[model samples]
Target: MERKHELNNKKVLVVGLAKSGFAAAKVLVKYGANVIVNDMKELEKNQEAKELINQGVEVHCGSHPLSLLDKPIDFIVKNPGIPYTNPLIDAALEKEIPVFTEVELVSYLTDAEIIGITGSNGKTTTTTLVGLMMENNPKKPIVAGNIGTVLCEVADQTDVDDILVAELSSFQLMGVQSFKPHIGVLLNIFDAHLDYHGTREAYGKAKARLFMNQTEEDFCIFNADDQEVIALVENMKSKKVPFSTKQTLPKGACLNEGFVTFNDERIIAIDEIVLPGEHSLENILAATAAAKIAGADTNQIINVLKTFSGVEHRLQYVDTVEGVKFYNDSKATNILATQKAISAFNQPLILLAGGLDRGNDFDDLIPYLINTKALITFGETAPKLIKTAKEAGIKVIEHVDNVEKAVPVAYECSVSGDVVLLSPACASWDQYPSFEQRGDMFIEAVHKLR
Candidate 1:
């Protein structure tokens, strides 16, 4: 693909030298933009910053000098992780200069259509399902964003004829200005990232940006059962398509008698779906809606639905030890997520729960723990979690400093038929860097039992 000339002769500031920022800076340089890359990490430690310097782009390492923006700049390309509260970002906004993420830059880089998906949960599962559904299409589909691959990394390789399937987050979606996906898929929303977003309403408002720039020609598929999601996008301009698990919708995707359907056309039996939980069922319905709209065959849709087990770290079954099974659902970083994970099991459950204390009351998750064999809590919120379990009449409860210790405790506590589950209902920031790392520890601990 030819370089986009729109950025030529433009002075752009690329903030935060992470993957997204590095990718965006390279793309900008390719388009003849005068790129100045900024990061707080020292130059000796930042390989990406060093690479930018070698490419003739000015590198400002160890700090984001406001002086870098003192010169007239066309716009700022920011890493999605860089918050709006960052002084540079705050300064850019005050100057009326546009600040965007790599996802936005990709929207400008290519004329290809986009299929964007975002939710408090289920975004990865639904996005992966939709990408699989579109993978066989003759037009070609690329899966990127939030699900590991940065959007702009795939942008230059695509053309107007290609389609980009993106798994977006509130962090990514919150940065969009003119960026718009051809098809916007909004899964269920819940209270999340309150530390960053500040309020429940603010978080919802950030999520609502998935449909912000959509036009009449674009499509908006959302969860009909989520009153909060529905309430936010009531006046969206795009064509509204909804998927439901509670009741059959006259339009879009719906569940009826265990069969997933789209506009009354049968797709697959709910039991045939290899992924567990009613949330996964809802994801299938949502994915089917997008897949059918993308012109996937009914037979192909059914095949994928039956074969797709799930994404990693979300309700994933690890190896069993001496007749005791271990499951890794470290992706359940919130109370609602843990609730969904618990609902997927019927076996005797010995649950491992807890994480960073975000001031969340786990009261909502107590009902789901009624018949569990035991509850093992860990991380910063262990005491709070133990109290919740004891109050709910969960007989056996234990607390650990982290998941590394929780695993061994769970192993010793589990009987022959019991399932030891690690589904921490809070973020892993209190101990581990990410939920994936926490899940990895659980997997490592289980493997060590041999």
Candidate 2:
């Protein structure tokens, strides 16, 4: 496949100076595209912007005027974080110039076999698992997009035979037009990113696009268990290979008689895989289905599944002191994900909760919180969570300041045979740089208490 946006001395506008933005800017410059990069902040003080300027890419920080788009430019490559509602993007759209995303930009640069995975939940795990499954299989895959590295960086080092297991988010998916993967996996859909998507249906449509452009010759994997994903696949024009953990699927992968069977050819007992909760098991099942369709052998896929120690901050066991286990599930940014973390354990818990509220429905989490000893809440959404839990007849203690205050209280409350879980059913933008940072700070606080 020929590379898209060959650059080759064309003018390009790269918006937003995030990890993806910087990576995109570097590539645009390298390909001889006259790059004018912009961010909402000034470049002189911004580390990433300063680095890009040092590399000689034209920098426009603080703000990008609409008049800049009035001039002739080949195209605009947008960062996923910047919404389509932005005036700059609207102007570019009105001009009839092509607007692409970092994912689209990188997809065009490489001839590598791409595996695009998207969903409201379980996407990161699916992305990493697929990469690990292929690591020893001579593919030597690169996991990029929303997971580890940015797409531009991955594209810089990629070749055709090499696969890119990209964990694409809704933000990345929205601007995609010509981006089609060799294998596209939609794990499961739930209410997430509602603030950006504005509606559940809109978010689902973004996820569905993963397979929208896929041809009959390409592999599109669906989760039969998730009705949203299944319904979308049913209506999709693309040929789909489906997977289900709950029951047998006639076409792709299924669970039958206590064994996971893929294409009715290979079977593995659920006990053979070491992933912790039912959610992880489902993730593995989805990944196995996609991997098998991608020409990976069952035994090799099963071997990797048994060895993979789930992703960090997704039900990661932090430490245990005095019989009280500490589990860091800070990646639980929605009520559904939080409930999964809570349900995985039967023991009484002291849940350290709260973060940036994303219009979460707290009712689903009430039953689990009622089972918990008491709730220790913190951050931006703490007050709302406190009210919701109390309204539902669950005892919750609100500590609406920071993780520093919440951790020790949770530690003090936890006793023998209890688990302390930091599963904030909200975004981490309130107090940390990322979810990993939130989880790390919680771990550090636990150590101090210990």
Candidate 3:
């Protein structure tokens, strides 16, 4: 790892001790910074904090005491999930202390050429695709960030020749200062994470941060079909590479004569791609543009596209039980995502959906539920989803306790040639800790039916 002289002897405060916070604290110490780690979890409960304390880093746990800021803190490395409304964070901001996520630390730690991907949806899928495409390059590809592995951890091991394919979220992007990517992909934007950002404008600005540090030498691949994405990148300094599913792009990636083409060069046939859903087309175009710019040949991009099905919890096909197929789409945490998942298949769908209600009605989901034969709802949004199902003319509606309970009901409602899909159109926080856990529960429940 490159030694960051800027952090030497600096007193840096790490707020929240999750994976990112823990990684940041360790890296900070390695760069000769006096690290102070803090978390809401008790010190005994926070093994990460305990480990950091052993490394001569000062750690305060159990609570975020306002007194911790009494000392002169150079800056803060905050956990992305922690809101700005946090008492400590608000105070720090008011004091004009610089606050950032671990994402910023990555720019200081690694010399690797970064390819950052961000959007309301398709981030994981697009990042995975770009990672796979860059695998054969002389500079190895390290896929990290919000996809699972923390970017700071990957940055430590990355060399100058390496490429970091990062799946960035608005939460992570909001905290970035000078984090720039050699190739930045903005897939699409929608109304999401309003609770954290408090406004749609804030959310869009956060997503737009991917290209904020890019120069004319860098490349930015964006969705031309999304007007919001278009408007956001109008002033970007990076070379604009537009990808579209709705129209043909003369200079970027787009559909041309039934082929996925880049700059008039045919990459792959539209129908030949293995990943399901029309919504996936946007992800494909964005990844194709990014991969092509990252030195991936037509064959390399085609190879990954033809074979890769999908990322887990995002329309992943599970086992086929009694001639019925099951797809786990627990990652569909919004109406647009659920609409895409439901539209992917033509089979009679027994959709298992519902989770944390973000104060939005399910009216937008009604039109997409036309193919849905039965609706199995759960979590806090069950009533709202049930009403939507009724409006969509879904005759059979079953409100269950959770995803595990909804699976069996979905199977029971299914027949031969039918699909039992778990595509919850809300966040899983209402019942499970994360959408991954909810998807796992659905997978386990599906296996139990066998």
Candidate 4:
């Protein structure tokens, strides 16, 4: 846990007052860095800003003032979700000042080997599973990044004997410079955050950065089933390890004769796995590949796969109310993610979807809707989703204002053999602060059903 770089008396600007930003500022201060925490919210509303001030770190609230940059700044640790279009970020770049994501900052501060996971979907689940599998490792793996804890918050607590299992996102990977992972996992790439990256190609480039700094000595674990993911690494330099749900790979993880095989070794049976869906299968394969390479034992992999149901909010079963099964997949914040979640079952389905529009085209999901018994829509994208459902020739459709209404109504439209699934193909910001909150509401609503 020794500091790799001296930060004593260095000027560091921690941008955005979110968890990652605040964590980075606290770490910087502990290192004797002169830290300035900037946030757009008013100080009275920003508890994080007040906390940083209490730690002797300077605070700049309300807006990123031009004067904040007037002072000489050393480096910037940015919140992953903060856009480059922010004037403060643009000004920092205009000044040629380097901006770093919390993970990037942690990479320099700790020697603990990183197992970085990234993709449009499944990163959170795969990251959690990998952490669980690696728990039996001597390194004592710690899960961080987009899953919950910012790496900066826990980096100094880890030693060379520890492993940092990070759930990375396109946003986090976009700003990375020298952030290399000893084990890099690319789950699967799809058209996501187009409003942020402006194009699918640009978004793919951001996720591809997860492998940018890896070398021949490092392992790049990727999804071979995803054409985009495979195409994204056509010229990659790292040691390649591909996981697949379809075709069996000669050297990586794959589904071989109903067994989850790792390099031709049968590890676990597909049916015995509690976590359902082909997408979950892919996530397990990816995590298994990464964990095995990271020195996890075969027995450890089998043990975790048989027990690790899933992370919260991704196709998590809520209950069976009146013979209607309820599932929370609120983490399906993109079109493809929702599609994958819904595709998990052959049972009659009452799908509840909608949220912040994000300008996502629902065209790709129409074919998946062909099997739905009913389509309930809500939030900002409700109308669009409803229209797409109708066009797909769905007979039963319901529209509501929010997920609170979508859940109960979806239940009403469901039969005994049907699943009431909340898989919003959009973000939760239109109704709740995060997808977790949205999924929690669905779980709460389902619990209310008699």
Candidate 5:
């Protein structure tokens, strides 16, 4: 791929004033692109907005009116937080204006190698792991996208030989037109972000598009354990390479007899991955598959795999006080994720669960609760969760509206050898700014109990 010399003098509308939005605006401005930014709040109220203004970027804070995008524009760069169905985006489309995500925009301008990764869970972990493995290749890879800074900012400062390991979300994948990668890693897919995508099928379609744009020269490393992803290979026309924890793949990576095997000649024992649980094992398999396909040395891959620490907020251990173990799994924003956390624990659990509901099915979680000694529900989803648990013949206790009330009740109910886990199976809009904030509050409340 060849790099473009300049992106100057083109009008680019950057929507959403979040972290990704700020990074996109900064990168576009640096490239001499005419960048117009918009957010649904005042500049003084939104920190990112104020920062962009200080950088001399023109911003329309407090709403994206039709007039904002009605003018002539080269392309519209959007943040993942803004849904595809937004009226402003729709209006831009009606006028034949092109809309690209920050990821797509970055891909268009860089000659750097890209390793795109997407899944319902462990995308951050896998993205970070891939970056670590590539560090041995002498490229000194940069991990970005949904995990940290936007990809364009990383590319702006990167040389032609550098590698980009991107953690792409379902929303980010939607705006991409032809953002193909040299190595594409598809981790296990589960029900997540249904509200933005509208349905499970729609969400899965967006994720599947990551591989749809790839060619035979590129590699699509998939999770064989996920039926949804594997099914896409059977129907799609792209180059398909599958990996799994449950079965062996003929081309990609898989677990066989307690070993992580991938490519055609590379193999490692399950212990080589050295992650926390079985789910993390799957993440390692997917990452190893992508790295091996990209020509990473087997020894370098194993060394990086063993040394990488897991990402925060996903099954994070808070503290152990007087034989009670507490975990902060605020990243489990869906029912299937909470189910995975429950399977990882063997002892009786005092599970603290709830948040802004996304119409999640509670039936899958009832068996885990029945095995537990006590269940405490909080957040706006508490009543709905309690009702569903009761229908499944499980007993649940309700607390006040937030984690502050629920954490103490869980602490009181926990006994020696019992675990108190906060793995809300819904979004955090009810009482927090983001999942990170929710996880922080849960950790702080647990500390207060100590």
Candidate 6:
């Protein structure tokens, strides 16, 4: 890429050895940087480390020794998940060395305009919609970042005419220094990842980084209804485009007379949209704003909104067993997300909820549990959720061992017309390694009932 000169002969330490780290290390090596990789996993368990070692890069596994900082290191490329509170990271900061996530490398690797999407919820859905909307455009779309693919890898192969549609996490955005998106979309912000961020303010600041480097020429698509989003974008340099479901906006994407409109031009009738929920409507408006700004026509936007159901694990509809429809919303890793999922359906819900206890209560979720027929709780937060269920007057609350166990319990409590929803209002780290695994287990258990 374009910024290879900045990395050539520089000593770059790549912390953490996951997909992002591996991709970062390889890119650093390709740019002629002296790369040193570190991870907590043992060397034998880290196949990526071994492969990198063969590429003339230094590999350090099993520990992040403070001594790694003793050398004259130029900078660090850290995995997004590794918090700044990490001892090595803290030490590096004290020494005035720059630290970054692999996301920072995206700006250096490609000239393609990037459309970055971030929020506490609905990020994946909006990013997916924008990617689909841009499919027929003259500029190709390379979807990457937190949606799974390493962004730098996609950036390396991207041409100047391409567009990078990325679903970014707050963690990934926090490490970016000069990264800027041509079109930045913030769906909504909520209390999330407090354990890593230490406070809601820090989390919002990280999400705001998506537009930090954008100029007045760029566009920032944000939620007009969310006060937190409005407050955060109050002083951004980019041209602000607000989308809302609560009120009609005169100049941005909004609902006008039961239709989705951008700048007062109708795109599609809301009733014809395939995705369910008011939250999905918010995503559609945000995506519509970004897609239209990036040269997508009304027909291109309507095509995806009509056919796209949703990304997997975010209110994804699973198979129907015995007339009981199941939905996998395991990606609902916070109170607001689960609240939105619960509000999506009028069908009596056999809600499956619980996961990592992030020092938050479910009291806020009580108001939305009015129609829930039963609550199946699991993971570290089971007791807390059970308490919330009882307070909500949910009489049929059952505490199960895990998601798979909860599936059968949910089905057992359900009759023909009830909806079984696996929308845990917490992170999946307490039992399953990821939310996708938990969702897969729930899907497998639902299949077993057949």
Q: What is the TM-score of each candidate against the true structure?
A: 0.95, 0.95, 0.98, 0.96, 0.92, 0.98
CA lDDT of every candidate: 0.86, 0.81, 0.91, 0.87, 0.80, 0.92
Candidate 1 lDDT over 303-339, as tens digits, reads: 8988888888988889888999889999998998888
Give me candidate 4's TM-score against the actual structure: 0.96
Error of 1 at 28 (Å): 1.4
Sort the predicted structures by lDDT, highest score first: 6, 3, 4, 1, 2, 5
Superposition TM-score, candidate 5 onto the true structure: 0.92
Model 1 residue 230 CA deviation in Å: 1.6
Question: Is candidate 4 or 6 superior in TM-score?
Answer: 6
lDDT per residue as tens, model 4, 1-450: 355457888888888878888888888888788888889899998998888878777888887886788899988888888899888889899999998888777765888898999988888899999998997778899998899788778887888899999988889888888888999999887778888898899999999999998888999988888889889887889999998888978989999999999989899999889888877888899999999999998888888888877779998988998799999999998888888998898998899999897765688899898679889998898889888988898899998878888888887787787899999889999889999999999999999896
TM-score of candidate 3 versus the correct structure, residues matched by position:
0.98
How does residue 313 of candidate 6 score in lDDT?
Answer: 94
Model 4: which residue pairs collide?
none
Q: Which stretches in model 4 have alpha-carbon errors above 4 Å?
A: 1-5
**Model 1, global lDDT:** 0.86
User: Highest lDDT, which number?
Assistant: 6
Model 6, TM vs. native: 0.98
Q: Please estimate how well model 6 matches the true structure, expressed as its whole-model Cα lDDT.
A: 0.92
For 315-350, candidate 6 gives per-residue lDDT tens digits of 999899889999999999999999999999999999
Stretches of candidate 5 above 4 Å error? 2-6, 234-239, 263-266, 271-273, 304-309, 392-396
lDDT of 3 by residue, 383-406 (tens): 988888888999999998999998
Residue-level lDDT tens digits of model 5 in 1-450: 544345678899998867777888887887788889988887678888787778888889887889986567998988888877889988888888888788777665777778999989888878988888777686668888888677777777776778888899888888888677778877776777878888889888889778777766877778777788887656655567787777766777777777777755656676666566677887887888777766677888888777665668888888998899999889888887888887778888888888887766587787766566677888888878887667766554656678778888888887889989888888898889888998999899989986
How much is 421 displaced in model 5, in angstroms? 1.1
**Model 3 segments beyond 4 Å from truth?**
1-3
